[model samples]
Target: MVSQPMPLLNGEPHVGVFIKTASHQVVEVLGAAGLAFGVIDGEHAPIDRSVLDTMLLAGYACRLPLLVRVADGSGPAISSVLDMGAAGIVVPHVDCPEYARQVVAHAKFAGGRRGLSTSPRYAGYGSMSMHEAVCSGDETAVICQIEDPEGVQNAQLIAQVEGVDALFIGPLDLAHSLGADSVREPVVREACEHIARAACGAGKAAAIFLSDPSDKAYYQELGVTLFIIGSDQSMMRQGTRALSSA
Candidate 1:
């Protein structure tokens, strides 16, 4: 993280679904419609170089921030996303500050020295000057997930990590880890609030997954701005239900 003050750009807080399949056209269409960002599913979905390139192109054209949610944080793929020109990254299953530090290292080119690659999709395929590209990297976002019990315990330290932009809470995973159902569970809700408060205390943004539209504004009121409220799959399921009824 650069000690030098850098202007962080927070795009609209969006709620989106876990895009589990690689469909470039669908990814492009949904983003164009509206979604502050899309977490390209590197964790559960089949995302390859070609699909990711297309998705990144779509996000770039729409001016929507695109993030890759890595199933495992800090490895080969995380480095690839930064190099591919993703707006930022969301590392899932982060358990501590050590994990957060690794996330920053892989996402940033400053101290991490993530090998300079020009003529890459992220660098506009050699359109951007090497110096300029490196500079943009400094402002790139790095979101870490706090899902497991250990992660929630260390949520503050994780958020306090220098380059961490947000601490996202995976309600379901967290609830499961705590031996409770995720959706509409009182235990999960409390845990979510706990993580949010710690993130607020640590001076990092709090991101949560919200499934219902009515609940979206509530979290924003609670000072949680980054919300993944719905997903493409859920929307499709809702639509299919309507269609079947009709």
Candidate 2:
């Protein structure tokens, strides 16, 4: 029988928070705050594998699903995080169906080239059989980021690619690609809506990074169910301001 997919990609409304730092404390805090998952920002953060491993362990302890947004969707990049016990991978800048396929190729082991290592943390450190490990890896989530104009244009095709569990809209980079003044520009909003429609049409999840919670209702109306709202640094700044004002 086919096993169930990971929680992150189970066609449910999930909320995630981004972690730019290597602090396990932040993961603990976010878990306490009731976020469904935590994403480690490897794309922009200077986090080394050692730090990432620690954070992953912490998240596991906290019973929170931890996904790594790798620097890129390279095979090695995706394989390393999977071996480290990440619940899934979030690939950046997938502009076409081929790129989305490549991301899955690296994230999934059935048709992909992910190296096998039953001794890794993901396999229970040699406890799990190779067959079980491979099946588990295949079920791991693969979320593709649709950031550029090309990605938005091909969003539907990308969503239809097998093993691509979700489409995440990176508004900042998308705004840059569209030559818009800000992510809130009408043009960017239109592009986001297009991508969301594509995801919904393909029976996949539509996700976004919303800096402001107030924008949630707008995107929700457009069929966006997965929301990654705010980051560790932004939360710190807000906390600092609150403390200083008190």
Candidate 3:
């Protein structure tokens, strides 16, 4: 709850972007874009642990609240990122209520008993009081990614999970699940709309997977608070493309 994009929850909306660039280079550029926050997508992007540690450090230095999309739900895959101090976790393909419950438990210490270490960067390297760190760890989000047809069918139950603050729709996955390769198809859009309505009704935020800078109004109409605008690779290409086209 603490890590939610407050704009979406409190009746305002923040437009954010996704970072798929090298961890080092993206950190400085990420904050300069005038967006709220960024997701360092370790799940889809190829990034190493050593580089990730550095990237997160630089991200913290720049004061960008980061959400790391965990590649999997396994103990090491998810727990290691939380232990390393990611402010939020975007878990993909969470279809059932038990999966939703487990995501929360893994993110929370009292709820799931994740191992803790004082010297990690997430705790400011032991600068934070034990109580404060514990509170932070417990409250950090475990966002569910409703990416498939099955997940969309059960989006409401997934959103209602005790610690699931939001349900994020992955456009590509949704499209694929709908027997298409492109997200612009009507079937995927319709399903996403269904997920959005379910999230709003359940008192949880909905995150749109589109990263287009021009899609603000579209997401707003659906009550989406968290916006992953564009990937780092896309930004780099667009920047260069714009210059040439100009």
Candidate 4:
């Protein structure tokens, strides 16, 4: 079966949350809540392959497109997550154009070195043909994270790279990389804007992580369409704090 177009690629404003709970139930809840999407925080969370598998299954059943933030952006890591039926990947620390190209190459079956597999869940348990699998795999969004100073510098070139669906700003890491104390610092905001402009100018989606959901409108004005506002853990903390106060 051919893959459907991802919402993030539609150039429209979409808001999602990061998944740190490693629970399929959470995925189901998020989907039922009508969130546009969810990103499994494989980069910082304790989600293993088994957990990922279950979450993807739940996401599919609930109509939630769940992407993975891979700790290692290697070809094997990227392909493995895609094979398990992830909606796409959020590869971290893509600091250069060459690295961006490598990410795209590893993600695409046409111009990249992604290993083919019809046995994975993504191919519907070997029910799909090789051509169909390849077509579906190639459609998965390949988002490259711009988290460092070098990444901000090469944002334009990275955005210009073919096959890169979006440029996601990891603001916390980016602020740390730039020796800033907070993501709200003017310098950090400036860098974020520059990256957003670069991505928008190249006609790619500009994505960002925001601790405060209220900040989305600010970034939206900068041409950022993809917003990851908060994570499961953070939401739970806020809920409990509110309960305690009450």
**Clash pairs (backbone) in predicted model 1:** 15-229, 16-230, 17-230, 17-231, 119-126
Q: Candidate 2 clash total?
A: 0
Candidates 1 and 3: which is better by lDDT?
3
Candidate 3 segments exceeding 4 Å error:
1-11
lDDT of each residue in 1-246, candidate 4, tens digit only: 234236777878999999999899999999999999999999999999898889988888888888899997798899988988888999999999999899898998998999998988888888998898988898899999999999999999999999998999989998999999999899998999999999999999999999998999999999999999899899999999999999
Rank all candidate structures by their TM-score, best first, as comma-separated numbers. Answer: 4, 2, 3, 1
- Scored by lDDT, model 1 comes in at 0.74
lDDT of each: 0.74, 0.87, 0.77, 0.90
Candidates ranked, most accurate by lDDT first: 4, 2, 3, 1
Error of 1 at 243 (Å): 0.8
In candidate 2 the C-alpha lDDT for residue 144 amounts to 92
Q: Find the candidate with the highest TM-score and give its number.
A: 4
- CA error at residue 1 for candidate 2, angstroms: 22
Q: What is the C-alpha lDDT profile of model 1 across 1-246, one tens digit per residue? A: 111121223534555556656776777777677666677778877778778877767666666667778767755767777776777778888898987898788777888746676666666667777787677665677888888889988888888999889888788788789899555788778878888888888778888887777777767766787877667778888999999999
Candidate 3, residue 166: lDDT: 89
- Residue 201's lDDT in candidate 1: 83
Best by lDDT: 4
In candidate 4 the C-alpha lDDT for residue 201 amounts to 98
TM-scores for all candidates: the values are: 0.90, 0.95, 0.91, 0.97
